[model samples]
Target: MDKIKVIITDLDGTLLNKEHQISDYSKKIFKELYDRNYLIIVATGRHHLDAMPLVAGFDFPIYLVTSNGARIHNPNKELLFSFDIESDAIKSVLDLEIDPEFTTVLFKEDVWQTNKTNEKLNKFQKELNYRPEVVNFKNETDLKAIKMFFTHESHGKLIELRDKILVNHDHLFSHAFSLPYCLEFMDKSVDKSVAISKILEIENVRFDNAVSFGDGYNDEKMLTATAHGYIMGNAPESLKKKLPQLQIIDTNEFDGVAKFLAASFLDADVLKN
Candidate 1:
C-alpha cells in the first residue's frame, strides 16, 4: 500500500466521540501524524467556527471543509474556495410553503442566520457552543448563502420538504440528510468529494494517497472518492450496505478513528492492547 499523504475525516460522527468531543487519545494520535507531516483535513457539515472547538487542541494547522463542502479554508483559516448558494435559490427555499414546525438555518460566509429557534437548535448550540443570529427572513435580500439546513422531529415531514424542493428546484441544489431529522442543501456542484478533490490538487496529492472517514449521507461521495475509505460502525446499516467495499471500523464512541490510524500508520500495539 502507498503511504497516506492526506487524512480527511468528518467531525460529528467520524472523529468526535459520543460526548461530541475529540478524545485525548485521538488527539495524541493525530498530533503525531501531523508531526510526521501528514496533511490533516477536517471535512464536515459544520461551519468552520463550530468545527473549531472539537479540533482546538491540535497545535498544528489543518484544512477545513465546512458546510458540507460549500466552503474550504486553508490552515490559516483563509478562504481557499467557496461555492455559495445562489441568491435566487435561497429565496426559493425561503418562499416554499412549508410547515412552520420546521426550522431553517442559513449559513453565510461568516455567520449563520435563522428566523426561529427551537429545542433542536438549542441542543445543537449546546453541543457546538455556537448560536445562529435570529434574523427576519422576509426583509433579508442579496444574501450569499453557503448552505441551508432544515430540521424537524418528523423524518417524514423533512423528507416531504426535500422531495418538494427536488421536484422544482433540483437543478439549483443538491440535498442530503446529515442526520435523520436534519436535511441540508448546498449548490448543485458542492460536496465533500469535490472539495477534497480540489484540495488534493492544490496539495499535489493523488486521490489514492488520501484516506477519508465518514458516516453520514453527505459523506458517501467523499468516502467513495478516496482509495481508502472507512465507514464507522455506528453508521446506518443502509449506508454500509451501499458501500460494501469500504472497511468498517469501530464506532466513534470507542475512538474508532484513532484506533484505525494507530493500527494502520502508527503502532499496531495500540490496537492489540
Candidate 2:
C-alpha cells in the first residue's frame, strides 16, 4: 500500500453496474473518499458531455479524462487539456471504402455526428441517453475530431477493420476496443494511462500512490501504469490473462470497487452483509 492519493476508474463496465449507473453503495464510498481529500477521477472512452451527466449528483469536484485520454476536463466541464485527431486523419478515415455494415461516428468538441444509422447505433444511443446528429461528412470542414468510433455486430469484422486502419494510418492514430463490437480511434499518443499520468503530475502525486479499476481492453494501459490496479472478476478471461500481475476483485455488479475501497482505505468492511 503506497498510501493511495488518487483513484482512477472507467465508467461503463467498472464503476457502473449492469444498468450503466453507479450503485448507491459505490456513491457513498466515493463521497467518503472525496470528503477525505482523495482525488476521484473518471477516465473513460466516453465524451465528456455524456460522461458528466452520469456523475452529476456527486457534489464534490471530480475530474474527467474523456475521449479515451484525448481530453481532460475539470469538474465544471471546463477543458483543462486536449489532444485532437488531425483533420487529415479524420479525412482519411472518412475516405475509406468500407462496408456499409459498419456504422461510424465522428466526435467533435460539442457533438457527435454520424450519417448512417442502424440498430446498433440506436442501441448505443439508448445506453448513453443521447443521440448523435445525423450529418454527411462531405459537407463538414475543418473537422477537428477528438475520436472516431466504428461499430458492428461481429467482433471478427471489427478486428479486420481495425487492422486495415492500422496498416494504412498507424502513425496517425491509435486504436482500442471499448467493447467487442466497438472500435475507437484517437491520436497516436492517447490512452487512458496518458491521461492518468498527466493527472498525477498535476496533483503532485506519485505513480505508486494511484489506484485504478477497469474491465475493458481500453483500460489495459491504465491498469498497468498504476501500482494498485484491479480487474473486475466479471471481465473477460482474455483481459484477465493480459494483466495477471494485478489483483482480481468482485464484479461491478457486486459492488467490487466499493468493497475494495472500503476495505483498503476506509478500514471497514462494507461487504460484511
Give each model's whole-structure lDDT: 0.85, 0.83
Which pairs clash (backbone N, Cα, C closer than 3 Å) in model 2? none
> What lDDT does model 1 reach?
0.85
Q: Which stretches of candidate 1 lie over 4 Å from their true place?
A: 125-130, 269-273
Compose the digit string of candidate 2's lDDT tens values, residues 148-229.
9898889899999999888889998888888777899999999989887887888889668889999888999888888789
Q: How far is candidate 2 from the true structure (C-alpha RMSD, Å)?
A: 2.1
Best by TM-score: 1
Task: Specify the highest-lDDT model's number.
Answer: 1
TM-score for each candidate, following the candidate numbering:
0.93, 0.92
